[model samples]
Target: MSHPQIRHELSKIETNLRIEIGQLAERKQIGIDSQGTNLCELIALLTNAALSDHPLFSQLTKLDAAFCQLDIGLYGLCSDCESEIEPERLILDPVEQRCALCAESYAHEHRHELRLTH
Candidate 1:
């Protein structure tokens, strides 16, 4: 994709993520009490936990760093191999830092490390 398109998409993603995160923060502060039953309370607690550790939160954090890279004109390059990432992949996830091959390789290595540790 062109630089302008990438910037536009990233800007939109950044804005949406910020808005969602702010809403989540507000909900967290107010607490998610159902005040119905024990099951309801448990469900609320679990939902809060899930949202707190949600992958979207991590993506937002990564996107913040990605924006810095975008400012430097380096956003689309793989962080591991420094190759140009696939445009389709970027459209799917603007926060992605590595190409598919590199990401697969890293995941494989990570799994191996986890196995060894276990």
Candidate 2:
């Protein structure tokens, strides 16, 4: 697909997701007013919503913005070696503008940060 097409699609998804997230946030806030609810359960619900729903959707929005720039050829090249990013990797993760080598190095360097925190 063309760059404009990809960007347009991403934008549409981002807008829709933002609206959904806002609605969920409002609902969650309303839930806090419920009387006699278990405090642990309430905290768990809010934490789950923020960590899973909110962050997942928000991350996609950020990725969309970054990908839009890449689509216009502004950040399409890898920063490390100045090589063009592989099309396959880009297809897998459209927001990824780094080449394989640079990406691998980055992942290796930050491997510990990828672990799940509880």
Candidate number with greatest TM-score: 1
lDDT of candidate 1 over 1-118, digit per residue (tens): 7777777887787667655655665676744332322333333453556763665556655676677788898998998999999988888888889999999999999899999998
| Candidate 2: worst-modelled 10 consecutive residues by lDDT | 32-41
For candidate 1, which ten residues in a row score worst on lDDT?
33-42
As a TM-score, model 1 comes out at 0.67
TM-score of 2: 0.51
Error of 1 at 96 (Å): 1.6
TM-scores for every candidate against the unseen true structure: 0.67, 0.51
What are the Cα lDDT values of the candidates? 0.70, 0.58
**Best candidate per lDDT, number?**
1
